[model samples]
Target: MRKDKITSDELARLCGVSQGTIDRALNNRPGISPKTKQKVLQMAKDHGFIKNQYASSLSRGTSNLIGVVMLNLKNEFFSQLLTSIESTARSFGYTTAIMLSDNLEQVERQCVETLVGMNAAGILLCSVIPDPAYGKQLLQYSTSLVSLGNHICGEIPHIGIDDCAAMFDSTRYVLRHSYDHIYYVSPVLSRSSKENIDAQTQRFKGFEKAMALQPSVHYTVLRDPDTYQSILKSIPANGGRSAVICSSDSYTIQCLQLFKNSDVGIMGFDNPTMLRRLYPQLSTISYPIDAIGQLAVKTVLSPVKEQKSHYLAHTLISGTTIK
Candidate 1:
């Protein structure tokens, strides 16, 4: 027999035991004598036997693999989230199979289908599409789905930060600095597909709410592909105090570079380590990304019931950029 392709039946025959006994011994299932189990394990180890978890799961009609689907892994937040989820799932005796969607709806759908084909016990998805119909399709395959970052408008359990509250608090922090002009800077969604608009809309609503509370203050919203250039032109030439509250850390870092020599207060969201290391003075609302990962795993493993959404809290980390 080939050492690499050693099977349970082969091991059982060599050990003078039934295949059922070998299965029970290898999986640590009940109904096996300890002495026989030890002997079988040693013999299998000596013969270079390696159990196939996927095949075993297929035979049992269930899987211990948790599927994780997300957008591109270039961002620090997504990378950290993947690591946290993998680590947390392992503690629960589950393994993770991660797939990147590259922020494409079709890619996301394909990844979900592949995971379902693998019989993933549960899926933790950072969906590129937040449509109810798409969400329904996902539920048709498996009800054990936990959405991260963005929530679908359906009965899908969601684990993410309250974008409205996080942006509101970040806006208030910028207001406290007494800047005369406060601007909410976000990416222009005009080119984005319909399915990818929910998250941006939610954050914009929070910014609008905070701006409404201070009607007397001069505030504006700049939706631009080149936020730094637009913000630079918007600032008064005669040295008026201006501050920018960006919807993401990447935009905030760009704004920081734009106003490096000026006294402009800047606040961003998602306090990533790279931003902190490069610009220690940058202020941001730090979302509980690690907690989101842990909560997602717990939600996936729990018994399927009514869909529920979980909102983790965000912290406003004060830094020199916010003055």
Candidate 2:
């Protein structure tokens, strides 16, 4: 049974309650009785009504829809963002529609358009679209939009850490030690291809800037996706204290699998929760997920969008992986 087959009034009628009671029960409002709430939920389930936010939006009202667009939810960091964003949005009396771009331009654009068509009150985007023109076009759209992470969308104000500074500091951490060689791992960026996220570029800029101060230090940029694994493997692990700094924890997790307890030290950004179990000793930067996600919802739902990008502080965790 589809959700549309059962309206709020129909469910309320079957449950022997007013539509108001059903609304409170559906939204989990405190005014509803526990027994009534359970009854309503069971009825909803038995009838095959969807329990997703999209289904919730019907009862809450379409005007309260908050659309969230993300690059992908394959990693712990972004998944954390989803949980935080949805929780925060719900607290603000809004229902969210989460969509994925899979790092594709066409898909991301389609997602934005779909939300716009749905009359979303606002959109929170962590985009993979490579063009700034689309962002400028978004500026003219009727709905409010706030970039969640990347800063590439036409001077869009994004909620992100000082990526350059974060990487710069991470690089310096390895540099502070006697490490003779450093290799920075990042997804390759192709402007013509639009295959990568610019947020990765900002991190690289930071690493590059920090590396510039120490010309004597041997540093290599492994930004090519296809070649980084082979190139990283070919390098002699036994050489003078070498460190490989990964741009993301997802990539670092792979490196952790590849290197295990080798002499080559590994460092990753945003120590993902799963990584903690897999490699407790891996050093990483811990960015504030709660702060970033809450702020993203606030900025996107505001009457006026934020003009300047916001930066939050990040924590560096030192683990035994570097030693």
lDDT of 2 at 127: 74
Q: Write the per-residue lDDT of candidate 1 for residues 136-192, one digit (tens) a residue.
A: 777777537888877765588888888988888888778877788887777645434
Model 1: CA > 4 A from native: 1-5, 16-21, 28-38, 191-193, 226-230, 233-238, 304-306
Q: By TM-score, how accurate is candidate 2?
A: 0.79
CA lDDT, candidate 1, residue 245: 85
**Local accuracy of candidate 2 as per-residue lDDT tens digits, 2-75:** 55556666787899999778778877778987998999999988776554555554544456789998888888
Clashes of each: 0, 0
Best by TM-score: 1
TM-score of 1: 0.89
Local distance difference test values of all predictions, in order: 0.81, 0.80
Q: Give candidate 2's error at residue 323 in angstroms.
A: 3.0
